[model samples]
Structures are given as C-alpha cells and as structure tokens.
Target: MSNPVLEIKNLHVWYRTYGGYSRVLDGVNLHVYKGEKVGLVGEAGCGKTTTMRSVLRILPEGQAHIPEGQILYHGNDILKMKPRELQQVRTRGISMIFQEPAAALNPVFTVGTQMFDVIKYSGLSKEESRKDNIKRLAIQAIKEVYIPDPERILNCYPNQLSGGMKQRICIAMAIVTARELLIADEPGTSLDVTIQDQVHRLLRGLVEKKEMSLIMITHSLGVARELTDRIYVMYAGNIVEVARTSDLFANPLHPYTLGLLSSVPKLTGGGVAEGIYGRIPDYLRPPGGCRFHPRCPRAVQRCREEKPLLRDLGDGHQVACFQV
Candidate 1:
C-alpha cells in the first residue's frame, strides 16, 4: 500500500492535577492513509478524546501535555514544527469536529460571522467571500448532513437550533475546510437515533466523496463497523487491537476487544448484554503491566507482570497481549 497521510507513533499525553499527574494517552500508535476511514472505539474516559486532541495539538494548555512520541503528517513531524507552521497545518492540513456543537461555537458571534471568518482566513478574497459564500458553504454542509432548511438554519444561533442541528452545523464547519485529515470526536453524540444514523451516513459520504482521511472517535461498534475500513480498540489510554474491520469482528484477539463485542446490545435478543466486569484503572496510578489485565477475563499470571508490545498477526492486524 502507499504511505499513510498521517501516522501516530507511541503518543503519550498526560495532565497535572491537584492530586498528581494523570496519564490519559499512553503509547497510542496508528496510521491513516489518504481516503481511509479509521474508527476508534472505547468506553467513556478511555482516552478516545485525548487521542484526537493530541493529533490536533490542541491538548488543554498547561493542564495536559504530549510528553512523548511523534505525530507525522505526510512524513513530517507535527510536534517538531514551529508555531507558524503549526498554524498553517490547522487551517490547511488538518481540521477537527468537536463532540458538542454548542460548546465549540462562540455564542456571541452569529453563525454567518464565524463561518465567513473561517473562509476568509482560508485564503479566499473578501469580494469573493461575503455572506453569500458563507451561506452557500454553510447551507451546503448542513444539507449534506440531512438537516432541513439550511438557509434558515444558517441565520439562526446555535441555541436556536436543536442539539442535532447544532451537531450537523459543527460537522459542516469541519468539512468546509476540505483539509486532508478530518478528526471527528463523536459528532453524533447528542443526536437522536434517526439523526445519528443520518450523521453516520454523512460522514461516510464525506470521506468517499472528498477522498479525505478520517479518524472517527466513537463508542458505537455498529457505527465503526459501518463506516471504517479499520478499527482500533482502546482501553485505559492503550490501544489493545488494530485490524481490518472484517477481521476484527471475526477474530478479535485482545480480551478487551472480545469484551466490547460481547457488550454490544442486541435488537431482538432475549438476554441482557454482558458488560465488562471492572472499571478502567485510575490513570494516576495505573497497573504495573498491561492496563487491561485487571479487567481481562483471559488474563493470566504473565499478563500481570509484563506489558506486551503490539504484535503483528498478518494482514495489518495487531494485538497487544501475551495471551493473544
């Protein structure tokens, strides 16, 4: 295969809190090629958002920091870049969609004002860029996500729109830049089931149509299975499994992967879904070896003593467990 558009190697991000230091992302390694769609699935607080934040270099200032590892975009190390270079990357290279729309948007600014500002900063001329261009892109983007009355919605404030509408608008803003890599941090989180499905479809279409790479952070395996070419299973800031979508669903090697699959709710089943037994270990004082060992049903004595490197199992599939 050709080289990936973006590659993350051994990413480690942590925060300094009142109690002590908390490591949220530890040794996260993955790659995203042009036109590829990759889904990252994990339970809440499993470092899914942290991983995405690391890529954007927007980790909470002072509170969280990328202590180790390199983020490479098209073979260039993003971490090593200067400030101006990084600013260019934010505008022209990589873009992000936050999980919550209301939180992302400026309540004080009109939607048109913010959207036009982004467009103007992107190198478009003022004459070429007006309320019309803003409305055009905003409407087109919102409509692509299946939101109705795009023109009317564009004029409305974030508070005026429902949660689902706001989410769609946020998605439109992210894709409007037409950047090479789009990092979506749970774009469908607050929407209803029907709206969630529409958001998923819109995301898939955006990737296919633009040939843009996507790193979708979500908790839904169903969405992952439907939209991603590959899937990475994470737990407690560690990536436990990386594999092609079909191979992952068919033969999940890591205990965490199996546990996640078992937890997926069934539509017409007679029994309740089985949940993972233990909670994620505290990042401030994580386990000595594999982070998942405490909760892994298949964990053995060795699992408690040694952390495993990601081992290749052929066909780009890898697992990080001695037992696997």
Candidate 2:
C-alpha cells in the first residue's frame, strides 16, 4: 500500500465563541494517500470545513484550539511545526480553495498581482527572479482552468469578473503552487449547473495531470460521486460511514447515509424528495452517546447511552453505527 500523504488522527477541535466552546471536530480521523481523490460530504455546518482548516493549522488561534490529536503530513506532525516549518508545508505541500472565492481574493488588487504573490510563495525559480517567468506561470495556470481570455482576466479586479469566472480564477490560484495536496471546500457552489460541470471536469484533469491528492468537501452527493474515489459521510462532527464511491452508492450501510440519499430528488423515483428534520444539536451540550441518536430511525438504547466506535466492515468500508 502507498504511504498516506496526509493523516488526521483523533482530532478534536473546540471553538471558544461567546456562546461557549463548540466541539467542532470530535475525533475526526481520516487518511489520504498520494494521488488519491477523497470526498467529505455532509449537511451545512457539520464540521466539513472545520476538518479541512484544522489540517492547515489556520484556525482562529484565540477562538479555536485542538485539544487533542495529531495531524501528520508525510510523517511530520503539523501541529508541532515551528512558524517557518508551517509556512513551508502550507505553500509547498498543500493548497486550499475556500468556500467563497470573491472573499478570498483581494478586491483592490488585480488578479495578476494576486496570482504573482501566490507564485512567489511557491518557491519556483521564476517566482521572484524574473517577472516575465512569473507572468508565464500565471498565464499557464489560468489557461489550465480553461479561461478563454487569460490576459483580460489577469488585468481585471475581483469585482470585474462574473461569479463563474472568479471561481475559475480562484481555482487557478490554488493550483499555481503545484502543491502535493489540494483541499477544495465547495469550489463552485454558487455557479449554475453548466458552469459547475465545466469547473469540476477541469478540476479532475488538473489533479490527474499533476498527480496531486485532493480532498473535496461538499454537501452535494452528485459532485462527490463525480469527483472522488472514496467518500466519507459526516454528521454532527463525526464521520458516520466511509466506503468506495461505487460501494457507497450501491450499498449505503449507515442510516444517516440512507437518509441523505433519500432526500435527493431521483428522476426515476417519481416522488417528492424526503428531507431530514431537526437542527444539528447545540455543541455547548451535544447529545450524549451517539450524537445522532435523537434523529436516527434505527437508533437503539445502546446508541443513546454509549458512543459507537467506527469499525471496519471489510473491503475498506467503515461505519460508526452500533446497528450496523
């Protein structure tokens, strides 16, 4: 087996908000081998973004802290890294595409200038040595994302481009570093169906051509199915089920996973889609035992009294439900 490029072991993060600390990530364990594509799917505010942000150690320092666990990147503990070491890992080892593209880019700066700054951190030979070389790299990255007018976009500010165009630009900036791992937190959530398809296809091509690992975080199962080799279903800060994409779509073992699928509007099913009710429990005092018991249809007494451990069910499938 190939060694894992990234490993998150028993991660627990707490955010010290005015309302009290939110147990954002409760023992989130995940692994991604080199050149692999992985998906993390969950409802809104279920710790998907939190999980990805924790890996980079970019969480608000005063507001959030990892109480326990280790984030290992190529055998080095990221949490223990010095400031200089962390900077190297962020720019040279991993890249992240934030959920909102416009907000990520500087509104005042031209796209080309912003991109050149990112290229500078890439440690590429031309990043600071030659302006023309950096420009060439920027143009190439933009072209890789299929933008027809690279020059026009390079001169424009963030407000000048349409949502889709801005999203593509954001993607270009993230991949410009040619890092080992790319974490895309809902890359094109605001784009129309047509734009989304095109962007997603471009993303797959880039990852394959570069042989970089990817972590796709989204609420859409369709996107996950289209882009990832394996999928992990997250709920209320815990991963409920994990399996190969084909296996997950064919045989969903967790009740929560089934509920998510049922909620999707199937063209063949011919009925209104079902929706999961009940807000995610308050993190100040989360539900005891299985955090999902109150809403889990198949929940038993054990589920209410004791947390279910994630167990391997052979063939790379894993589930945390006692009923499974």
- Each model's Cα RMSD: 1.8, 1.3
Q: Which tens-of-lDDT digit does each residue in 196-243 have in candidate 1? A: 888788888987888899999999888899889999999899898999
Error of 2 at 22 (Å): 1.3
Model 2, backbone clash pairs (residues 3+ apart or across chains), number: 0
Please report, in order, the local distance difference test score of every candidate based on alpha carbons: 0.85, 0.90
Segments of candidate 2 deviating more than 4 angstroms: 126-128
**Per-residue lDDT of model 2, residues 19-59, tens digit only:** 88888778888999999999999999899999999899888
Q: Top model by lDDT, which number?
A: 2
> In model 1, where is the ten-residue run with the lowest total lDDT?
120-129
Backbone collisions counted per model: 0, 0
Q: Give the TM-score of each candidate.
A: 0.94, 0.97
